[model samples]
Target: MKIFIKTFIFLIIIIPLRAYPQACCTGGAPLSSSLGVISYTGENLVIDFSYDFNTMKDLYAGNSQLNDKQRERSTNSTILRFTYALNNKWAITTVLPYVWQEQTVRSNVGKTVQSSSGIGDIVLLGQYAILQNKKNLVLLAMGPKFPTGSTSKTDNEFGLLLPPDLQPGTGSWDGIGAVSYSRFGIFRPTLSLYTLFSYRYSFQVGRYDGQQEYRFGNEMVINIGLTDSFLLKKWILNPSLQFKYRNTQKDENNGSSFPNTGGSWMYLVPSLDIELSPKIYLHSNFEIPIHTDVVGTQLVTSFKGNIGINYTLNFKKNKAYKIKD
Candidate 1:
């Protein structure tokens, strides 16, 4: 039936994100969380909305876990993604985020808390499918991140400027590139495997009315995952497990490396998806940090979780554009 075909197409989106792109210590939107999971084989417009909650209390010092619980930070982010297929081979996507961050530092004297909330940066990308078929797909995406958010969110306590990590936006233009390979039907029609590689390059920008210049670390991520679906008459359930490794280079200030700003991280993510209808789906995931190594002592994420919904609006397709493999 028509619903069956749509359901088949929707199964391609079962990818669990690299999940948290912005480190818990660095309070920014997790822009790369959903970038590589979109599907272009179908002729339609897909809208995805997600809310991510991340908390950090563990400290790491050069591959060693520290027992410091004096500082804690958490970020709440609401992200919306729109993907519109241009044709069978090309598409366009945009990501918008609204973020809120809170930091707490406790001492014997008392505790100091700082919070900031506002819009985050936006990303626009162009996607091209190098190969597409029912059983396999290869996709490439590249884009630039626009500085559309306010870098002016100040500290709630002193009204002074918050650090770059706590600011709503980075005030810099950045570039992102990604590639993904996916294959399904390995014995079972409802089973699949996928891998994604992505990188982000950051450019320096002036801050505080051009008085100081700073740059976040360049980042690279690799993800591999497996997903399987179980059919239960009228409903379907998809469960997935993903392994993600992320490397972030040291940040730069004026021209020098900034300490405690970059590190290597690995996570194990488990996700579940519920197909509500031919057009609607529910997605949720939990991220657990298995390993972390950082330069200097820095607070790292203890755990992260996100929930979202996906809706696809299908349009009439031009069969001629879809190449047969």
Candidate 2:
């Protein structure tokens, strides 16, 4: 029994730390509002603030070949999410993000640095509860992403347009749809499971730089997780393990597909959520890629970290009151 426990601990603590590929074309805030059960009673307002960072250093070709040159990219993102629940059945959410990015490329002449900082694209989503019970909950959501971020940022030293991959926005509008399902008390009283799937479809931009047409490929993401809860005196501790899969299509430029733009990746994530009070919660998570197969030679993510806080406010001031005659 002791050996089994040690093995489990090692798998959870050490296996997910290995390096992985950086995402090629898809660029958006890494944090999104979590899907949860809604009560059929008073209205609720939920706000979340999160910070995320990722580093990409090694380049890989096809599936397992590493290139010679050393190239690196780093990104830091801050995200804000707001959710309003009208009733137990319907909700709406908005997400905004600010991004700071740096790209370093190595060549025979030397290394060059390019950086950009701006507001990223905004996303608005509406969610509806399809089924809700004591043990299970299901939700459906759809949304549109606006190209509010800048795509024409230029480098400071060279005064030239930065690459499309480093731009804050994709220069095109996109649509996203999602389905989430969760089940509680499945194996034990303290264990719960959930799965979320989302798809994003991209639209073509006529002329991004007045000459070349550009469009990022459509993307899909899937996540499955299990959470175990422990009651620790006055606070509740919840630890979760999640698996995430992402697939993106190739990018198009001037009516032709670009190489090393998209691929499929799998990641393992471990997260912890701490409840300070009934209305306040803190969360942190780490993501590491385990499997990756790109179209060609591309930069990949080595590590990603996220930390956040969530606050829920309940209002019952406007509830219908009966007059006592």
For each candidate in turn, the TM-score is 0.88, 0.86
* Clash counts for all predictions: 0, 4
Worst 10 residues of 2 by lDDT: 316-325
RMSD of each: 13.1, 12.4
Best candidate, TM-score: 1
Which digits, one per residue and each the tens of the lDDT, describe model 1 over residues 51-123? 9999988877778987877777898999998988877788898989899998776655456676789888888
Candidate 1, residue 166: the lDDT equals 82
- After superposing candidate 2 on the true structure, give the runs of residues whose Cα lies further than 4 Å from its correct spot: 1-25, 31-41, 65-69, 206-209, 317-325
- Which candidate should be chosen as best, given lDDT against the real structure? 1
- The local distance difference test score of each candidate is 0.76, 0.71
